[model samples]
Target: MEELTLTTPALLFSAISLIMLAYTNRFLAYAAIIRNLSDKYLKHQDASVLRQIKNLRLRIQLTRYMQIAGISSLLFCVLTMFLIYIHYPIVAVWAFGLGLVLLILSLLFLIWEIQISAKSLQHHLGDIENHFKK
Candidate 1:
């Protein structure tokens, strides 16, 4: 393997930071949606509202997992850099590989969450369509 430099792991720092920021934004948006939906359901008790609540719950869970994975990747990247600093190239490579895998997993979960979010939006649009048909 090519020599592992501190710069190698450092490269992921900015990317991971950006990803974590995106994840946080998604999480905040979900939280706002859930709270608003909850208040609406309390007042109206609509079935469609219940369905939306369920869907948001699942999306929230997926977002949590994605955030967890991203955090793990960041932690591992830092560990890899520390290992490299200490002159442990072999273990550092392994840590770096694990970090990459975690990053990929986070991205996959993010994609899944986005798909669910789109479907939820479509459900809302279906309601609008039904209302217009009346």
Candidate 2:
């Protein structure tokens, strides 16, 4: 295995920062959608709207997990840098490895959320098609 260096962990700083930015954007979008959905559900009290609200709730939970994992990844990266600074090369390597694992987990959660979102959109489209057919 290669020696762990401060630069190695520093490299992830920008990548992680960008990922966090993307995650924040997703979260904000979800919030807006939730508010709009809530208003619609209150006005109509439709079963379809209720279903959408439930789906959004699940997606929001997943997004929260993604953000947690991403933030943990960034924390580990910082820890790795600190360990390297303190001359703990072995622990630094482990810290860096853990950070990478957390990043991978975050990406996996993102994929799951995207799949759910796509399925929800497809269902909405199907509803529109059915209405037109009737």
Candidate 3:
């Protein structure tokens, strides 16, 4: 087997670490929003607020799944880099490929959660419009 170049694995590991950090930040933001919504629900028990809280909970759950996937991918990327350092090209390639796939899956989940959030906002807007019409 040919000797591995440290630069290649180093760069890959850095990218993976950055992506995981972003994913974690996103999860933290969602969690904060959920907490805020819960606080609002406790202050006033409106049906619309209740619905929004439910939607937010669901979105948070989805985000949690994405966070899990992103973390898993990051782990795989680290393992791949280690393998590459040891000149195990085949296993390294497989691990890197799997990590790539997991990253893609996480992005897809993020997209879905965004769509759900948009829909929830739209529903709230419709309710506001109806209230103003009365």
Return the TM-score for each candidate structure. 0.96, 0.97, 0.80
Candidate 3 C-alpha lDDT tens digits along 18-116: 766776776787778778878887898778667777787888788788888877787777888888878888888888778779878888888998899
Backbone clashes in each candidate structure, one number apiece?
Answer: 0, 0, 0
Q: Per-residue error at 36 for model 2, in Å?
A: 0.8
Give the clashing pairs for model 2: none
Model 2 CA lDDT for position 42: 85
Choose the strongest candidate by lDDT.
2
Q: Which stretches of candidate 2 lie over 4 Å from their true place?
A: none
CA shift of 76, model 2, Å: 0.4
Expressed as tens digits, the lDDT of each residue in 32-119 for candidate 1 is 9889999999999999889888888899899899999999999999999999989898999999999999999999999999898888
Superposed by TM-score, candidate 3 places the C-alpha of residue 76 at a distance from the truth, in angstroms, of: 1.2
- lDDT (CA) for every model shown? 0.92, 0.93, 0.78
Clashes of 3: 0
